[model samples]
Target: MELSVTAVILTLTAILCLYYWNNRGRRSRLPPGPPALPLIGNSLHIDKRAPDRSLIQLGRKYGPVFTIWLGPRPAVVLCGYKAVKEALVDQADDFGARGTIPSISKVTNGYGIASSNGPRSRQLRSFAITALGHRGNGTSTLEGFVQQEAETLVEAFTKTQELPFDPTFRLTCATANIMCAVVFGCRFDHTDPKLLALLHMMDENMKVISSPWGQLYDLLPNLLDCLPGPHNRLFENANKIKSFLREMIQLHKDTHREGTPRDFIESFLAKMDEEKGNPRSEFNDENLLLSTFNIFLAGTDTTGSTMRWGLLIFLKYPEVQEKIQSEIDREIGMDRTPCMGDREKMPYTNAAIHEIQRYANIIPLNLPHTVTRDTEFRGFLIPKGMLVIPLLSSVLYDPSCWETPKSFNINHFLDERGQLKHKDAFLPFSIGNRMCIGEKVAEMQLFIFLTTLLQKFTFRSPVEPSAIDISPLSSGFSTLHHPYQLYCIPRRPARRPASE
Candidate 1:
C-alpha cells in the first residue's frame, strides 16, 4: 500500500513539473496578459461577453502589440495603426497564415482564401485578384455590374413609398442581392427560401462565434467536438450552405457556356477546367464552393450591417445628412439615380461616407493571421505559426490619425479646398497582399446606395431616439447593431432638386 501511494505521488509530481515548465517559459517570453489559471490560459479573460472592449483594456495595460492565449494557443494582437500597419503590411510575407480553429477547419476543410495558408493562400489570392481584374479598381466591368446592382437597390427602396418604414430588411435585401448578382448572376427577393436559409446560416455561424459556447468551443476544441450545442447547430448549418454550393457548382458544370463566362461562378469554373490537370491547381469545386461561401457571407453581412449603421448615423447627425443630400442633389439631380461615377463629383457626400467608415470602425481586428516562418518584429523573436491579429479599429479611430476620433466628423477626410483627402490610416478595407478582395465593390455599393437613398428619403430618428442603442452588440465574430428600427420618410424630389 505504501509503495503504491509513493508511485501515485511521483506520477502527480512529474505531471505538475511538465505543466509548470511548459507554461513558465511561455509566460516569461510573451508580453503581459490577463493571468491564466492552470491549463486554461486566459480563457476567462477572453470570454464571449464584450471581447473587443476586454481586448482594448488588456491592450491598455500591455503594449499595443501583446500576446494572449486562446486556451493553449498563443495569439499575438497588434493594436493601434502603427502596430497593425507594421504587422499586416510591413511584415506581410511573415504573417500570411490563418488559424484553423475547429469550427473553421470543419467548415472550410483547410481550404478557402479567408482560412488557408502557404501556397494555397497565394494561389487563392492570385486567382481572386486576377478574376477581379488587375487594373484600376480591378475591372470596369465590375464597376458597371455594381452600378446595375445599385440601380436595383434604388428601385427597391423607392417602392417603400412615402410612409415611415424600417430600412433594415430592405437594405439586407439590396445587399444580399448584390452578392447574388456578383456570384450566381442572379438576385433573390426577400422571401426566397434558399436566400432565407443562407441568411439564417450566416446568423447562426456568427452567433456561435460570439456566444459563451463559442468561447468554450475554442478553449476546449477537442472536448467540445463531442458535445451538443448551438456551435454544432451552426456547423450543421454551414454544411447545409456547403451542400447548396455543391449543387450550384454542379449546375455551373452542366450548363456552362464555352468561351463566354457569364458570372463569377462561370469564370471560376472555366479557370478550374483550365488548371485541372496542373499539379499546383487548387482551383477545384471545393475551393470554388468555399470562395463562393466566403463572398456571400463576407459581402452581404458586412455591407448590410454598415448600411444599417449608416442610416442610424444619418438619423443622429441631421446636419451631415442634409449636407450630403444637398451634395447629392447638386451632382445627381432629382429623378436620377446616383452612379459609381457620381461619387467623384460629390465631395462632401464622399467625405461623409469615408467618415462613416472611420467612425464605425467595424471588424475591430481583422481575421487573424499566422506567421509563415520564423521572423523578427523589433528585435522580438516571433516563431513560426504564431498568430498575428491586426486591430483595424485602432487605425480607424486613432487619435493621432484623426482630429476627432470618436465624434462624427466628416472634415477628417476633407481639406480646406473642400476636396476629399485620403489618409494613410484610413484602412477600413485593410492593406497588403491579404487585403479584402471585394473592397472596391463594397465602397461603390456603400456610396451609390447611401447617396441614392438619401436623395430620395430623409431618415428620421423615431420619438425617444435615445432609447435606440447606437452602440453595437457583441455578435461573436463581428460587432453588430441591436435589432433597432428607423423611420424613413420619403422626401419630395422637387423639394431637394438641383435648382435649389
Candidate 2:
C-alpha cells in the first residue's frame, strides 16, 4: 500500500513539473500581460460582456503590445493607434492572415471570405471586391441602388405618421433590401415575411455574437458545444441563413442566362461555370452560398446599426443634427436626393458622419488576425497560428490620437475652417489588407440614407435628449446601441415646391 502511494505521488509531481515548464516557456516568449490561471487562463480577468473594455484596461497596465492567454492560447493584443497601425498597416503582409474563431469557423465551415485564409481567401476576396465594385449594368451603380432604397425607407417612415416607433426593424429592412438587390437581383417589401424572418435570424445571430455567452463560445467552443445553450441556436440560425441563400442560388440557377450578369449572385455563377474544370478553383456553389451569406450578413447589420446609432446620436445631440441638416440644405437642398458628390462640398455633414462612426465604435475589438509565419514583434515571438487582436477601440478612443477621445466631438474630423479633415486614426472600417470589404457601399448607405432622412425630418425623442443613454446596450464582439424610440417630424423644403 505504501509503495502504491509513493508511485502516485511521483506521478503527480511529474505532471505539475511539466505544466509549470510549459507555462514558463510560453510566458517567456510572449509579450507581457496579466498573470493567467491554468485551464481558464485570463478568462476571469476579462469582462465577458465588454471584452473590448476589459482589453483596454489591460492595455493600460501592460502597454500597447501584450499577450492575454485566452484559454491557454496567447492572443497578442495590439492596442492604441501606434501599435495597431504598425502591426496592421506597416507589417501588413506578416499580419494579413485571418485567425480562426472556432465559433465563426464552425458556422462558415472555413469556406467564406470572412473566415478563409491564404489562397482561398485571396481568390474569393479579390473576386468579391471586384464584384461589389462594378455597376450591375452600365447604369445601375451601387450609389443608385442606395438612393433607391433611401426612397423606400422614406416611404416607410412616412407611414409611421410622425408617431414614435422603434425604427430598428424598418431600418434593418431598408438595409437588407439594399443587400438583397445587390446579391439576389431583387428587393423585399418591408412587410415580406421571408425578409422579416431572415432579418430576425441575422439580428439574433448578431445578438448572440455580441453577447457574453458568445465570447464564451469563442473562447471555449469545444467545451460549450457539448453543453446546451444559446450558442447552439447560433449554429441553427447560421444554417437557416445558408439554407435561405441556397434557395436563392437555386432560383438564380434556374433563371440564369449566358450573356449578362444581373447581380453578385449571377456574377459568381458565371465565374463558377468558367472555373468548373479547374481542380484548384475556389469558385463553387458552396463558396457562392457562403460568400453571399457573408455579403448579406455584413451588408445588412453594420450599416443598419450605424444608421440606428446615428439617429440615436442625433437625439442625444440635437445641435449636431441641426447643423448637418443646415449643411445638407445649403449644399444639396431638399428637392433633390443627396449624392456621394455632395459629401465633398458639405463639410459639417461629412464631419458629423465621421464623428458618428468614431463615437459609435462598432466592432471595437476587430476580427482576429494571425501571423503567416513565426514573427518577432516588439521583442516578443508570436508563433504562426497565434491570434492577434487589433484593438480598434483603442485607436478611435486613443487620447494621443483624438483631442476628445471619450466625447462625441464632431471637431475631430473638422479643420479650423470647418472643412472635413482626415484623421489617420479614424479607423472605423479598420486598416490593412483585411479592411472591411463593404466600405464603399457602407459609406454610400450611411450618407444617402441619413441625408435623405434629415432632408425630410427632424428627429427627436419624447424624453430629454441628455437623458437618452447612448452607451451600448450590450457589447461583446460588436457594440449595439440600446433600443430607443424617436419622433420624426417632417421638415418643409427650403428651395423646391412641396409637391415636387
Candidate achieving the largest lDDT: 2
lDDT of each: 0.76, 0.88
TM-score of every candidate = 0.91, 0.94
387 in model 1: Cα distance from truth in Å? 1.5
Best by TM-score: 2
lDDT minimum window of 10 residues, candidate 1:
132-141
Per residue, candidate 2 scores C-alpha lDDT tens digits across 1-500 of 99999998899778867978866765578888999876578999998878888999999999999989788567899999999999998999999999888888998898978989988999999998888877422235667877888988898888889899999999999899889988988888888889989999998989988887888888888899899988888999989889889999999999999987888999999999999899999998778888999999988998899999999999999998889888888888888988888888988988999999998988899989999988888988887788999999999999998999989999999999989899999999999999988887788888889999999899989899879999877668788888899988989955556794
Error of 1 at 262 (Å): 1.8
Write model 1 residue lDDT over 339-379, tens digit each, in one string.
76787898898888888777776677677778888777865
Candidate 2 local lDDT, residue 493 = 59
